[model samples]
Target: MVVEGAGPSCGLIDGFGRHVTYLRLSVTDRCDLRCVYCMSEDMSFRSRRDILTLEELTRLARLFIARGIDKLRITGGEPLVRPGILDLFAALSEPIADGSLRELTLTTNGTQLARFAEDLARAGVRRINVSLDTLDPERFRALTRGGSLARVMDGIAAARAAGLTVKLNVVALKDGTEHEIHDLIAFAHAREMALSLIETMPLGDVGVDRVDQYLPLDSLRRQIAGRWTLHDVPMRSGGPARYARVAETGGLIEFITPHTHNFCADCNRVRVTASGTLHTCLGQDDATDLKAHLRTSATDDVIVRLIDQALGRKPKGHDFILRRGASPQLARHMSETGG
Candidate 1:
C-alpha cells in the first residue's frame, strides 16, 4: 500500500518528520583486514548469494535518488576489496553528475585505497573517510591483525592529493592507545584533514570482553583540555557530522558518538544493507527486508510504502547502550551491517 511520491520528497519519513534523504549502501561483505574491534578470530562471513550485485545496487540507488535521496555513502566490509569497484563507482556516480545526487562518499579501512584513490576521485567520489583506530605501528598491527600502518598513511596522502576531502576516523578505546589521541589530532591538523573520534559500538563480531573500553565521548573531550575550540557548527549539506570544528590548528574534528552523542535528534539517514534490508536506525534492531518485498512487488509505490513503514518504527533515540548495559542486542557484526 505504498504511494510513488507521496511522502515529503525523501523516500521515507519517520514519525518525527525528518526527511530521510541519506542512504548508506554496502556493496560487499568482504574485507581484507580483520580489525579486532570489528571481527573475532572465529568469525565467518555471508554466502555469495547474500550480497547484492553492482547492477542491483545501481538500480536500487536510482530508485532512492528518484525519491529524494541526494546523498550516498558507499560502504562495505571494505568496498575496495570488491572487483570492478571503479565500474561500480562509475555506475553510482552518474546521478551525481546529473544533479540527482548532491554528494557521494565512501568509508574505508584505507588498506587498498593507495591503489584506487585517484581512480575513485575521477569516478566522482568527492569525499573519503578512512578508519584508523590507532597511530602506533605495533598497536595498529595488533588491532588490524594484517594491515600495514605505513600503507594506510600513504593512502590518506594519496586521497588528499586526488582532491578528495580526506577524513581520519579513530575509535577511541580505553585500553588500546588513548595516549595517541593528541598525536592523531596534531597529525590531522598538520595534514589539514578532518578527524573523528568514534565511541566503540557493541554490534560487531569482536569479543564483548572489551565493552568497558568503549569510552564515553564526554571523558574524551575533557581529556583534550581545551586544546582547540569546539564550535557549535551545524550539520551542513553533506552527511559527515552534525557538530564540530578545531580552531587552533585549523582542521576540523568531530566526536562521532552513537552511544554518547545520539544524533537521532536530527537523524536523516536510512541504511540499506548489502543484503537489501532497510534499517530505520543504525542502532535499532528493527528492519524491513526490501529484497523480498521487491521480488514480489517491484513497483516504486510499494517500495516507498515499505520504506515509510520502516521509518515509522524509527526510535526517537538509541538508549540501547544505556539500558542494555553498553551492549547492543542485535547480533549482526559491523561488516555485515555496512559499518
Candidate 2:
C-alpha cells in the first residue's frame, strides 16, 4: 500500500537536502567466493533466521517505492548466491510495470551469472555490475581466494548474450592488480562495457593490511590521464561513481574515490542488510532495527514513521579514513552491510 504522505514532493529528504531515491537492499551475506578485500577466508555469515524472508523483502520494496524510491539495486556478499533471489527480482518488477519504479538492478561477483543471467533479464534487470579485479587467471584466483577467472569471464559473456548491460567493477589495490588496469580497461571497452575502478575501503579485517592495499584514485586518475585522453562527463549511475569518457577506447571509466574524494554531499542512497538493518550512512553505525519493527507486526504507518525517524538521523557525510594501524571505521564488513 502506498503511504498517504509519500511521493516525489514529500519523499525522503534528509537534513542536508539530499533526497533519497535509491535503495541497495542486500538479500544475503553469503557469497560463493571470499574476495580478499571484501571478507576473511573463514567468514561467519548471518543465520537464516535473522534474514528477511522473501515476503518481507517484497513488502519492504513496496514500502520504499511508495515513499518515492525509483531505483532499487539488489546487493549482497553476492546477490546471485542467495537462493530464490530471482523470485524477489520478479516480484520487485511489479513496480516497474506500474510505472512506480524506474529501474531494478544488482551487483554480482559474476560467479553465477552464467546460470542465471537469462532469468535475471527476464525479471526486469537491464543492467548489472560484476566485480572482477584482474583478468589473469592466477591473479584472479588469488584475489578471490580460489574463484575461477574463466567462470567469471564466461558469466560476463552470458550476461551480454542475455541482453544485460554489464559493467566491470574493479577494486584498485596498491601493488596488486595495478599492472592489469590497462588490460582490464581495454577488455571492458572492447565489449562496450564501462569499467569502474574503486579505491579499496577499510571495511573488515580480511587479514590483509589496508594501508598496504589502499590506492588513492586521485593519483590513479592522473596516471590514467597520462595514457588516455580523458574528458570528464557529468554522468552518474545512481551511486557515487564519477564518470569520464576515454577518447582512446571510446568507452567510459568511473572513479569511485571514497577516501581521497568525498561523494557524500549528493548522497541519495540508503542500504539495508539481509537482516533488515537500515543504515543511513555507509561509514556510520547509526542504524535502525527495521527487522525488529517488521517482526513485531507493526502497521504500515508505524513502519513509515520509523523510516522517517531514521532519515532524520542521516548524517551530512561519512568518516572513512585509511592509515597504518587504523582500524575499520565500522565493525560490519561491506558484505554484512551490502556491497
For this target, which candidate reaches the highest TM-score against the unseen true structure? 2
Quote each prediction's TM-score. Answer: 0.91, 0.97
The global Cα lDDT (0 to 1) of model 2 is 0.88
In model 1, residue pairs whose N, Cα or C atoms come closer than 3 Å (at least 3 residues apart or on different chains), thus clashing, are: none
Lowest lDDT sum, 10 consecutive residues, model 2, at 1-10
Mark the regions of model 2 whose C-alpha exceeds 4 Å error after superposition. Answer: 2-9
> Worst ten-residue run, lDDT, model 1?
1-10
Q: Residue 9 of model 1: what lDDT?
A: 54
lDDT of 2 by residue, 1-339 (tens): 556566556688888778899999999988999898899899998889999998889888888888989999999989888888888988987888888899999999999999999999998889999999998899888888999999999999999999999999999998865687888888999999999999888898888788888888888888887788999999865568899999988999999988988888889999999999999998888889888877886567777888889999999888888778877767889898886
lDDT tens digits, residues 98-202, model 1? Answer: 887888999999988889999999889988889998888888998888789999988888888889998888888886546787788888889888888887777
Q: Give candidate 1 regions above 4 Å deviation.
A: 1-11, 229-242, 295-299, 322-328
lDDT of 1 at 198: 82
